[model samples]
Structures are given as structure tokens and as C-alpha cells.
Target chain A: MRKVAVIGAGMTLFRRRLLETGKEMCFQAVQMALEEAGLELKDVDAVVSGSAPDAFDGVHMKGEYLLDGAGGVRKPYMRVFTGGGTACFSPIAGWWHVASGLADVVLVVNEEKMSSITPHPQYAFANIWDPILDRPLKPNLVWIFAMEMNRYMTVYGIEKADIARVAVKNKRNAVDHPAAQLADPNITVDDVLNSEVMAWPVQRLDISPPSDGASALVLASEDVARQVSETPVWISGVGWCIDSTMWTNRDLSFPEYLARAAQQAYGMAKIENPRKEVDVVEPYDPFDYKELHHLEGLLLADKGEAPILTREGVTQRDGELPTCPSGGLMGVGNPIAATMGIKTGEIYWQLAGKAGRRQVPGSPQVGVCQAWGDLMQFSSVMVMRA
Target chain B: MVGEEYRRWEGDMEALYVYTAGVAGDRFFREIRDNERLMGTYCPECDVTYLPPRLYCETCFSELNEWEEIPNKGRVDAITVAYVDDKGERLARPKVLAMVRFLGANGGLIHVVDLPEEDVYRGMEVEVVYLPRGLRKGSFLDILHFKAI
Candidate 1:
């Protein structure tokens, strides 16, 4: 397989509402990516678009509708969906395009217009579960996360304050991030603990607000990458997996499916010990407990140990093994499918020494980004190196 | 200077589906209606009995026909006290919800339980209080609340 590298990355300001339509958002992100890569729209060979659930945007067959804005005019374009994992897996789809001699330069774009959904943005999430079994319960999305957090907490004897500290760190770290929507440097653990309890374990502050945003990356073959970028971040490994849709069947304390996905990526990267080898890490953090949950799933920390590392300030922007230095989905807006802004785009900035104030401590060499999706079933991981 | 108005289109489609109960669900619901006992599909390959049974085993995807009459009582895996409903309206009395796993069952049912907030804790056993046989509708709510045993 030929080597693939990320030549450029771009994102829109994640906001609760954007006047721009989904197509326009895609155009904005793709334009920035093309500009950064020094390539015109005509230079792109193929387009890989990622978005989740047409229900949110109220557009069925959304890919075809978004084609023109993605610069896929008269080009081979395909859409990918793996729930929230679409952000990270979209680039993986681009990697295969360049790696298999399919396309020289692939434009990977993701956009989520969550604000378009009427009522509360959280209402769209109600469809994520089984209508027959789960919908009968009249569940709001917060109940599921709260239940999972409660189970994980009970199993590990994890304190609520320890979990709240993750919210404190990521939202504070978001203060330096340009595209962050919920950045607040003054937020404390008490503030999180005392925040409105949407669900007992998951309070309003523990979760990321729904947002409208888009993110894009330019993936090119080895030759095209060298020409486009002086410091191309090489795609070392890509892995994705999905567990059972029957969420209640498995133990919710640990994300076993995510661990499997990471193992595949880590294996391909020849990374035997992620804790020692990976310098910067970005795990999907739609919720504060999720970052800690995924940290273990990625093998960066032992089971039930992510909270302890978090409490010790090891997960801060300038700490050892900085996780979600771009403020994560918690700090940045969580536009569901557009979270690649942190998972992939943030890693690119950190590796290229262009993350501005949110950059990691030292000369970082390797980073891993992952996302979870689809009713706690899907997981996607990418290992990148500078 | 005059401000130009932009159009914002908003319409909601009401989609309704006639979902088939399938082989397993059909049997599971029929038992609830005919007999007041809860049923489960036991996968012999895995030796695990699944509550809210499925036609195929989730682990091996093996076609499962073996059914068992699981006890109607189980311990709470988790409990939530909801202050509001789906419409974001506050309820007069907060609903107490629990995910109750029947004995030796791999999965459980999420239902509103009749238990006080202070008395509720993980692992507390609760029994399903089935609606009167006359009121049985073959739906999940046939069993009204899982009262404290």
C-alpha cells in the first residue's frame, strides 16, 4: 500500500446556530482545506463526505444534495456514516482512496447542521434507540449517558468529582481554542457538580451542547503530499469496529468495542505501548465520562484509571499525554458528525506545531484520535505521526 | 436602509410504521397477554438468557427458539428520577425509572418503577406488578410498575 498523508485541515466556528446551510458550511470548510493545501477545487480527484442521520438536517440522501458544495462536481464522490465516528472514519475512507492508487488527492469533508432540527437539538437524538423497546420508555438522550455513567461509576467506585474534573479541564482548555463554543476558563469542579442535573450522573455541564459546524481534511498520496505540505502528518494506521446494537447486553463500564478498534490501529502502527509511544491523544468526548471511558478504551490508561490521571492534571493541555488539547467536543461545539475539528484537525495542528495556544508541551511525535458512535456500538481510530 | 428577510422553512413529517413483532417478539408479547409470566430466549450456545428476547442470539446470531419463563422479579442495575417528560414539561411527581435485570438474564427491561428515591439503590430487588389480566394490551406497559418485593 502507498503512504497517505494529511496535507491540510480546516473547520468552521462551531456554534449553536449557523445561518449558513449545510452545503454552505461544507463549502466554507472545503475552501479553507483547499487553500491550505494550495490546490484548486479542480485539482481534487475524489470527494469523501461524512455526516450522520438525515433526521438532524431533515434531508434524506443528504450526500447527493451536498455534492456540489463539497467540490465533487463531476468527480467520484461517496458518503460514509458510522454515527459520531463519521468524523474520524471519513479520513480513513480518504486514506484507502490514496493508499490503493484510487485517487491522488482526496478531499474529506464532514458537516452537521444540528440546529436545523426544531424544538431542542436533543430531540433528534431520541431516534438513536430502538423504537419498539427503548422508545416506549420515552427516553431523552441524557438518560442513556447518565445510566452508563452510573454503571461505570458504581463498578469502579469512581467519585462524581473525579468525573466532573474532566469537564473542568476540557472546557477550560477550550478557552484557547478558536472554534470552541463552550469554552470557559473559570469553570470549576464545583460549578460542574452544582450545575443543572439533566440526569443524575450527567448534568448540563457534563455534556457538550449540540452545534452546527463543518470540518475538512485534504488527504493525498506520498508524492502529492510532499508537494502540497512541507510537514505532512502521515496516516500510520486506521481502524474501526462496531459492537452489538443491544446495548444493555454488555457491561457499560468499559468500552470493549473501542478497545478492539484501538488495538487494530495500534497494531498496524506497531505501537506496543500507547502510553509510552503516543504523545498527544484525542478520544471522542461528547460527554466528560466518555473522554475518561475512551482513554481506557485506547489503552492510554488502565481500566478505571483515567479519572485518576485526570485528577493529577496529566490530561491538561500542557501535561503529559495531553488529551483533547483543542478543548474537545466538550469545549468545542459537538456538531455530532463534524467533531473531526478536534479528533483529526486538532491532532494535525499539534503535529504541525500550529495549534497556537492549545499546542501540547514539547516536540510531539505521535498522536491517536478516536470517536464512538451509533448507540454505543461503533468505534473508529486513527494513528498519525509527524 | 431596509433589512432583507431570509426564508427559514420548517416542517415536521409524522412517520408511523407498523413494525412486525417477528417470531421471537410475537411469542414474547403473546405470553405477556395470554399468561401473566415474562418470557426470555435462552441461547444454548452461550448459556445466557436474554430478557426482551430476540429471534437470533446477539453474540453468535444463532436462530434461537428455546424460551424460558424467567422470574418476574429482578435487581435494579440503575435507577433514574426524571423531573420532566419528553416534551420538557415538568411532571407533578418525578418518575422513578429503573433498568431491571431478571434473574440470570443477560439483558433487562427499562421501566418506571414504584419506589421511593431514598429507598432506591443499585442491586435492590423489585417485582413486576402486571396490569389486571383484563387490562393486558400485549404491550410493554402491560406490566405497570416493578414494585418493591
Candidate 2:
């Protein structure tokens, strides 16, 4: 297979409600990415569109609805949905488009218009349960996540303040991100602890806000990337894994699927020691606690020890291993699939030395980004190098 | 061995969706409700006019900038008679639905036909019938139905 690299990336401002339609948002992001790569729609050979659920957009066949703006017209176009994992999985698909020699240049666009859902976007999760079992109980995402958080805290003897620190770090880091929606430079742990409680241990501040936005990336083969970009970030590794849908049957404290996915990516990237070899990390953090949980899953920290690392400033922007320096979903906004802008997109910028204010102190040469989705069962990992 | 405990379980799901007419859709629906006219977007690159006006052309991916009022007259491209409603309940009377295509348009609209099933033919010409302006809301409902012209 041929090597693939990210030549350009772009994202729209993360917001709760944007006046622009999904098609218009996609067009804006795609336009920015094409300009950044110094390429046009006519140069792209294939297009990959990613979105979370059709219910969020209130439109059936959403991919087809937003295709024209994504520059998929008269091209080999495909839509991929793996819940939130589409954030990274779409880029993985784009990688294959170039690696398989099917296309020399590929564009991946991910969009989510959660604001289109009335009442609350969480209402869309009500339909994602097992009709015969879970649906009868009327389980929403927060209620289940609360249960998982409680279990993790109970088993690990972790403190709420330790979990709250993740929120403080990410939100503070987001102050530098131009597209962030919830960036708070002065947010504190006490504020998080004092925030309104939605479920038992889950507070309003602990969760990321649902947002409407779109993100795009341009990927090209090694030779084409070298020709288009002076500092192309190579996609050296990709991995994805999904566990059983019966979430009740698994241990909530640790995500085994994420560990497996990360292992696959680390293996392909030939990094024997993630702690020492990886310079930067961006793990999905829809909830503050998830950042720590995903850190353990990615083997960046020992199981149940991520909170300790967070407290010691090991995960800070200038710490030994900076994590979520783009502010992540917690500090930024969670538009589900559109978070590709932060996860993969941020890593590309970091490795390319273009992160400006949010850039880690060290000139990071290798980075890893991961996204989790689908009833707490799906995870996708990607490793990139400058 | 079969057990009575393994029988079927029934459940109901509750989901609500509020759809926006979008940039192009708002303009199209507003024209029908306010002026009693049908509008379509023209794509010069593809030389095609799209009904239910879109923001971009599907064939060439060009941003559609030209807007034109399309004549309501069109021929029935396809017709279907429904005796049952969405919930599978028998309707008071059989309803006729037709896909009407306009001249110089790439896509068509599917709506209820005012004519009876016997009178609705595959190539019969029809025109849009709008509700009174006082009762019209900026929605597809503003166009009451299609009638034989």
C-alpha cells in the first residue's frame, strides 16, 4: 500500500446554533481546506462524508443532502457512520483511498447539526437502546455514563476533584483555539463541583455542549503531498475496534476495545513505548472523566492512574506528555463527528508546528489521536508524524 | 427446549425532529405561500434547473446563484393509488399521489393529485393548486394539491 499524508485541514466555528445550513457549513470548511492545500475541488479524486445520526440533522440520507457542498459531485463518494468514531474513521477511510491507489488525492468532511434537533439533542439517544431490554428502561446517554462514572470512581477510589481537573486543563487550553465554543480561561474545579448535577456524579459542566459545525481534511499520497505541502503530516498508523452492543455485559471502569485499537495503531506505527515515543495525544473527551478513562485505554497511563498523572501536570500543555492541547471536546464543543477538527485536525497542526498559541512547548514530531463512540463500544486510533 | 419466558417483547420509541427548510428551501416555500408561485434554482454549469431549489448543483457541484419562477404546469411522470394511511388504517377514500415533472427541470415533486385514480393518467398535465393566502403557512402544505389543468 502507498503512504498517505494530510496536506490540509480546516474547521468552522463551533457553536450551539449556526445560521448556515449543513451544506453551507460543509462548503465553508471544504473551501478553507482546499485553499490551505493549494488545491481545488477539481483536483480531488474521491470524497468521504461523515456524520453521526440522521436524527440530529432531522434529514434522511444526510450524506446525499450535503454531498454537493463537500465536493462529491461527479466523483467517487461514500458516507461513513460509526457513531462518534466517524471523527477518526472517516480519515482512516480517506487514507485507504490514497493507499490503495484508488485516488491520488482525497477529501474527508464530517458535519453534525445537533442544534436542528428540538427540545434537546440527547433525545436522539433515546432510540439507540435495545428495544426489548434497554429501551423499556428509558436510558439516556448521561444516565448510563453517570452509572459508568460512579462505577469507575467506586472501583478505583478516584476523587471527583481529580476528574474535575481534566475539565479545568482542557477548557483553559481551549482559550487559544479560535473555533472553540466553551473555552474558559479561568474555569476552576470548585466551579465544576458546584455546577448543576444532571445525574448522580455527572454535572452540567462535566459534559461537553452539543454543537453544530463541520470539519474537513485533504489527504494525498506521499509524492503528491510533498508536491502540495512543505510540511505534510504522514498518517503512519490507523486502527479501529468495536465491542458487543450489550454494554451491560462489560466492565465500565476500563474500555478494553480502546486498548485493543490503540495497540493496533501503536504496532503499525512501530512505537514500542507510547509514553516516551509519542510527543502529543488527543483523546475523545465528551465528558471530562473520559479524557482520563481514554488515557488508560490508550496505555498512556496505567489503569486507574490517569487522574494522578493529570494532577501532577503530566498531561498539561507543557507537561511531559501534553494531551488534548486543542482543548478537546470538553473545552471545545462536541458536535460528534465534526470533532475531527480537534482530534485528527489538531494533531496535524501540532506536528506541523502550526498550532500557534495552543502548540506544546516541545517541537512534537509524533502524535496520536483517538475517538470513541457507539454505546461506549467503538474506538478509532490514528498515529501521525511530521 | 422452548420456554414461555422467551416470548416476544414489544416496546415503543419516542423521538421528535424539527426540520428547517434550509437556505434554498426557505426561499422556495416562502414564494409558494406569499406569492402563490413555484421557484426553481438554475445551474448554468450543468444546464439544468432543480425544483425544490437547492443551494448547490448536484451534477457539477457549483453554487447555484440563478433563481427563476417555474410554471406550475407539469405532466404526471408516475402515479400511485393508496387505500391505506401511514398507520395502515383504511382511508375514507382512496388517495391518488403523482410525481409531477416540470419542463426544463431536473427533479420533480411528489404530492397528492386532486383527480380520481380513474382520471389520473401517466402523461396527464396538472397544475399546482394553492390554499388561500390567509390560511397559508410557509410550508409544503401551502400547496394544497395538484389538479388537472
Candidate 3:
């Protein structure tokens, strides 16, 4: 396959309620990315739009509704949704558009308007469960995730404080993010521990707020990229995997789906030791413990040892393996599919040396970003290089 | 076990949504409700006027910063007579629905046309009959219907 490179990236402010519609947000993000790449809509050959669910935006056939704003008018446009995994999966779809030589330039847009859902966006998750087996239980995401967190803690003998440290580090790192919604520089572990408990062991502070936002990335063939950008970050590898829907039957402590996804990406990227070779990482962290859990799943740390890395400050922005330097979903806010801004977007910025204040200490060449979604069943991984 | 009868369970998806009109829609609807005027966004590059006032041009994908006041008069591009309500119940009077396209605009608005079935024809000019100012809300409902001009 031919090589693809990310030439531009854009993101809107992560907020609880944005006055702009999903189409408007997509337009703003696509405009920024086009401006950054010094390209026009006519230059785009195809478009890949991503959003978590139709319920969140309150619009059916959301991809078609959002296509015009994403500059997909009269173009090859397709929508991909894999729960929250669409953040990175959409970019992967853009990669194939370029790699397969069907398109020279592709724009990938991910948008979410979670605020449109009344009461709370979490209410949308109720429909995601199986009608016969899962829906009857009236289980919400926080309740299910609480059980997952409790399992991980019980299996590893981990402290809540250790998991809270990820929140502290990411929120602190978000202080430098211009579009972050929850940046708290002086936040402490005690603040998280003392926060209101939504579910046992899962406090309100540990969760990222549902947000309204859109993110865009411009992917181009190597030739077009080299012609347009002097510092194009090549998408060296991409991988995604999803496990069965029966989440109750599996081990919640470790994400086997993420591990398999990471292996596929690593195998293509040809990096044997992720801990040493990967310069920066952006693991999905809608919940604080998911960050550590993803780290182990990515094989960046040994099983149950991810919390140790956090305790020693290994995942800090300036640490040995800086993770979520864009403050991740925890600090920057979680807009579901729109989190492509911090996941793959942050990785591209870091590898291109354009992360500004949120930049890691050393010059990083390779970065790996992962997004988890579905009923703890989906993971999408992308490996990028400067 | 293979010959056992299957039982089915019933459930309802209790999902509710509150959609905002967004930036352009807010401005467009506000103009209609407050000033009784229709607004359209113009793209100089594409030389296209977008009805419903989109923030950007769909063709050229350029930001449409230019706003123009469109006359609340248009010609019916398409018409359909609906005999049933949304729930498929029969209605006493058929609703005249038409896609009204404004002159010099790239898109049109689809709404009910308050005209007799015999009078409603494609290309027939129609003018918007808005609700009274006191009853106007910043929404499409503010325009009661289009009447034959």
C-alpha cells in the first residue's frame, strides 16, 4: 500500500453546550484544517465522517446531514461509526482512501453534539445494550465501568489514588490546551478521591464530561503531502479490533481488544518494544482508570504495572513516555467521536513538533494513539512518525 | 431444548433530544420572527445564494460571510398532497406540501402550502403567510404557510 500523511488537523472548543450545530462545528474544524494545510475544498478527493450515535446529535442519517459542512458535497463520502472508536477509526478510513490510490487527498471529520440529548448524554447509552440480555438490566455506562474499574483494582491491588494521578497529570497538562474544557492545573488526587461518587470507586471527578465539539484531519498521499507540507507526519500504521458484545463474560481488568488492535498496528509499524520505541502515547481516558488499563493493553507497560508508571510520573507530559499530552479525554473533555482532536490529532502535532506548550520534553519521532469504544469491545490504534 | 418455544421480550428506548438551530439558523429564524424577513447567505466565489442561510457554501466550501435579505416570495418547485398525518391517520383536509425555491438561491424550503389543490401547481408564485408578530416564535413554525400570490 502507498503511504499516507496527515498534513493538517483542527479542533473546536470542547464544551458542555455549543451554540453551533454539528454541521457548523464540522465546517469550522474542516475550515481550520484546510487553512493549515493550505488546501481548498476542491483539492479534497474524498471525505470520511464519524460520529458516535444518531441519538447524540438528534439527527438521523447524521453523516449525510453533516456532509455538506464537511466539504463532502459531490464527493466520495462515507460515514463510519464504531461507538467511540470512530475518533481514530475515521482517520484509518481516510488512510485507506489515500493508500489505495483512490484519492490523493481526504478529509476526515468527527463530530458529536452530546448536549442535544436531554437530562444527560449518558441516557443515549441505554439503547446500545442488547434488548434481551443487557437492556433488561437497565445498566448505564458509569455502572458498568464502575464494575470494570473495581475488577482492575481488585486484580492489581491498585490504589484509587494511583488512578487519580492520571486525572491529575492529564488535567494539569490540559492547562496548555487552548480548546480544553476541564483544564485544572492545581488539581490534586485528594480532590478526585473526595469528589462525589457516581458509582462506588468511580467519582464524578474521575469522569470526563460529555461535550459538543468537532475535529478534522486532512490526510494526503505521500506525493501530495510532500508537495504541500514541509513537516508532514506520516501515518505509518493503523489497526482496529472489536470483541464480542457479551462484555460480562470477559475479563474486565485487561482489554484484550485493545491489545489485539495494538499488536496489529505494531506489527505493521514494525515496533517490537512499544515502551522503548514509542516516543509519545495518547490512550483513550474517558475514565481515569481506562488510561492505565489501555497502557497495559497497548503493551506499553506490563500487566497491572501501568499504575506504577503513573505513580512514578512516567506518563506525564515531560516524563519518559508522555501520554495524553493533549490532556486526553479526561482534561480536554470527551466529545465521543470528536476526540480525534486529542487522540490522533495530538499524536500528529507531537510528532510534527507543533504541539507548542503541551509539547513533550524531547524530540519525539514515533507516537502511538489508541481510542476505545463500544461496550468495552472496540479499540482503534494508529502509529505515526515524523 | 431445541424444540422449546421461544419467548419474546418487549422494551422501549426512552431517548429524548433537544436540537438547537445553530448559528446561522438562529440568525435566520430570528430575522423571520422579529423583522418578518427571510435571510440567505451568499458565497461570492460560488456566486450562489443558499436559502436557509448556511454558514458555508456547499459547492465551493467557502465561508459565507455575506448575508442577503431574500424576499418571502418564491415559486413552488415541487408539490405533494398529503392525505394522512405523520401517524398515518386520515386527515379531514389534505395538506398541500411544496418545496418553495426562491429566485437566485441554490436551495429551497419544504413546507406546507396553504392553497387549494387545483390552484397549487409547479412554478406557481407563492408568498409566505407568517403568524402574527405577538405569536411569532423563532422557528419554522413562525411561518404559518405559503399562500398563492
Candidate 4:
């Protein structure tokens, strides 16, 4: 297989609302990434666009609309959506493009404009459920999360206070992230527990707010990567999986789908023990519990043992296995697929030791980033190294 | 480039989704109407009883035909006090929604719990409340919700 590396990464500030449209945001991120890679639109061989849920953007065929803005005009622009997992999947698609010797330079751009929707983005969430079985109930998005978190808490006997620590840690860690939306250094566990109960176990602070943002990555074959980037972050492995659509059929406490994806990625990366070999970590944390949930799924933590490690500072930014130094989705804002800014982009930055203030203390050699989407069905994982 | 106020328009999506009750779903509803009892699709292959019956097993692709009688009594797995509806509109009073997990059943029911918010804690025992036989429509709404026991 041909080698591929991330030569450039760039993103826009994540916020509840942005003046720029989705197309404009796409251009902003793509332009920045191209400038950083010292390349131009003419140099790109193919393009892959990742945006999720047209319901949130209030437009049909959103991919076709944003193609020109993403610098995919007249190029092989492929729009891929696996719900929120599209960010990682975007890079995975881009990697295979170069690895297959089909495209030397593949530009992958991701964007989400949840702000375009009315009253709340949660409205778009309603359409994701099964119309016959689950839609009649009219579930709020938070309820599903609350149900999962509550089940995890019940099975592991995890205290709410211990889970609150995740929110406190990620939001505080976001203080250094320039694109962060809710980076509050003063937040505490009490603040999280005492916050508004959107759902019983899910508090306001525990959940990431919907934001409008865009992110871009430039992928190149080994030869092009050497010419374009001095510190190229190589894509070591990629994996993704989807669970049964009948969400009620499986155990909600454990993300078996995500675990399967991680297993495949680990196998490809030849990583025997992720708990020790993985130098840095960034698992999708749209909710505080998700960080711990994905950690166990990645086999970085023992089953029902992640919360304990989290409380012990093992997952801190400067701790042994610094997790989500980008403040994650909770602090950095969750723009659906555009969260590549934290997942793919953050890992690249961390592997290159360019995460700035959020950077880990030592030189990190390996890192893993994962994303989850759909009705807790789809999961994607990508392992990268310097 | 976005100016202070760009030309914008508002429109509602014009899409309608129609769903059909599958094999087990149809049979389950009919049984609920006949006996006012909950049924689970028991996958003989995997020995897992799916609460909301499905024609096929999730683990094994084998078709399931066994029907297991689910105990109407269940403990609350989770509860949420929703103050708004699907449209993001605030309700006059918060509705207590609970995930009622029946014993020996693989999946549970998500419905309104006829209890106050403070009283609807997880692990609290609850029972299914069925509507009068004359008013039953042979549908999921047959069991209005779960009531705290």
C-alpha cells in the first residue's frame, strides 16, 4: 500500500452563529489549509467533502451546493456522510485516494452549519429516528444521550460527580484552543452537576452546543508529503463500522460498533496494546460520558474502568495519556462533521507538536482520533503518527 | 461574503415519511389487542428476547417466531423530565419520560411515566397502564404509558 500523510490542517472558529454561509466557511477552511500546505486549487487532484444531515443546513443536495466553495469545482468531489462520523471518514476516504495511487494530492473539506436551522438543531435530530418504531415517541436528542449515560452509570455504578469531571476537564482544557466555543477555565464538577438538566443525566454543560464551522485537511502521497511538509503526520491506520439499525436490540452501555472499528484500526496499525503505545488520544466527546465511553471502546481503558482513570488524572492534557487537549466537542463546539477540527486536525497538530498551549509536554509519536454518529450506530477511527 | 444582513428566505421541508409495521410488529399489535399483554420476539438461536418484537434476530440473521410474554412490571432504567416537545416548544408542564426495562427482555419501552419528576428515579418499579379494551386501537398507543408502582 502506498503511504499517505496529512500535510496541512486548518479550521474556523466554532460558534453558535456565524455570519458566513456554509459555502463561505468551506472556502475559509480550504483556503487556509491550502495556504499552509503552500499549494493552490490547481494543484489538487481530487476532493472529498464531508457534511452531515441536510436537515440542519435546511438545504437539499448540500454537497453539490458547497462543491465549488470547497475547491472541488470540476474535480472528483465526493460527499460522504456517516452522520457525525463523517469527519474521520472524510480523511479515511482521502487516505485511500492517495494510497490507491489514484490521486497524489487529495483535499478533504468538512463543514456543518447547524445555525441555519430554526429554533434549534435538535429539530433536525428528530428525523434521524425510525419513523415506524421510534419516531412516534418524538424523542429529544438529549433523551437518547441521557438514556445511554444513565445505563452506563447504572451498570458501572458510576457517580454523577465522577462523570461531571469529564465536562470540567474538557472545557477547561479548551482555554488554549483558539477555535473553542465554551472554553471555561473556571468550570467545576459542581457547575456541571448543577447545570440545567436537559435530560436527567445530561446537563447543559455536559453537552456540546451546536455550532457553525468548517475544517480542512490536505492529504498527499509520500513523495508529495515530503516536498510539501517538513513535519508530515502519516496516516497509519483507518477503520469504521455501523451497528444494527434497531438501536434497541443492542446494549447501550457499551459502544460495540466503535469497539469493532478500533479493533480493525489497531490491527492495521499493528498496535498490540493501545493503552501503552498510543502517546496521545482524542475520542469524540460530544458529551462528557462519550470520552470515557470511546476510550473503553478503543481498548485504551478496561471495560467499565474509564471513569476511574479519568478521575485519577490519567486522561488529563499533561497526564500520562493526554486526551482531548483540544477541549473536544464539549469545549471546542460540535459542528457535526466539521468537528474534524478536533478529531483529525487536532491529532495532526498534536503529532506535529504544533498544538501550542494545548500541546502535551513530551514529543508524542502516535495518536488516535475517533468519531461517532447516526442513531449511535456509526463509528469511525483513524490512527496517525509522526 | 456575508454582509450585516444578507438576502435570506425561510421555508419548511416538504417531505413526508411513511412507515410500515413489519412481520413481528403486526403480530405484536394484534396480540396486544387480543390479550392486553406485552410480547417479545425470542430469538431461539441467540436466546435473546427482543422486547419490541422483530421478525429477525439481531445477532443471527435467522428468522424468529417464538413469542415470549414480557412481565408488565419493570424497573425504570432512566427518566428524563422533558419541558419541550419535538418542535422545541415548551410544554405547560414537564413530562416525565422513563425507559422501562422489563425483566428478561433485551430492549425496553420509552414512554411517559405517570409520576412526578422527583419521584421518577431509576430502579423505581413501574407497571404498564393499558387503555380500556373498547378504546384499544391495536397499536403501541394501546399501553398509554407506564405508571409508578
Best by DockQ: 3
DockQ of each: 0.01, 0.38, 0.79, 0.01
* The candidate that achieves the highest TM-score relative to the unseen native structure: 3
- Candidate 4 residue-wise lDDT, A195-289, digit = tens: 99888988888899999899999999999999889989999999999999887788998999998999999999999989889999999999999
TM-score for each predicted model, relative to the true structure = 0.73, 0.91, 0.98, 0.73
Ordering by lDDT: 3, 2, 4, 1
- A17 in model 4: Cα distance from truth in Å? 0.5
Question: A46 in model 3: Cα distance from truth in Å?
Answer: 0.6
Clashes of 1: 0
List where candidate 3 sits over 4 angstroms from the true fold. Answer: B1-6
Compose the digit string of candidate 2's lDDT tens values, residues A1-386: 89999999999999998867898788878888888899988889999999998988888899999888788988999999999999999999999999999999999999999988878987787877777787777677798889989989899999999999999999999999999999999999999999999997999889999999999999999889989899899999999999999888998999999999999999998989998999999999999999999999999999899999999999999999999999999988999999999999999999999998998987999999999998889999999999
C-alpha lDDT of candidate 1 relative to the true structure: 0.86
Which 10-residue window in model 2 chain A sums to the lowest lDDT? A132-141
lDDT of each residue in B42-100, candidate 2, tens digit only: 99987988898988775555678899889879999999999999999999999999999
Interface RMSD after interface superposition, each candidate: 18.8, 2.5, 0.9, 19.5
Alpha-carbon deviation at A204 in model 1, angstroms: 0.6
**Which model is ahead, 1 or 2, in terms of lDDT?**
2
Off by over 4 Å in 2: A19-24, A58-69, B1-6, B121-125
Model 3 RMSD in Å is: 1.5
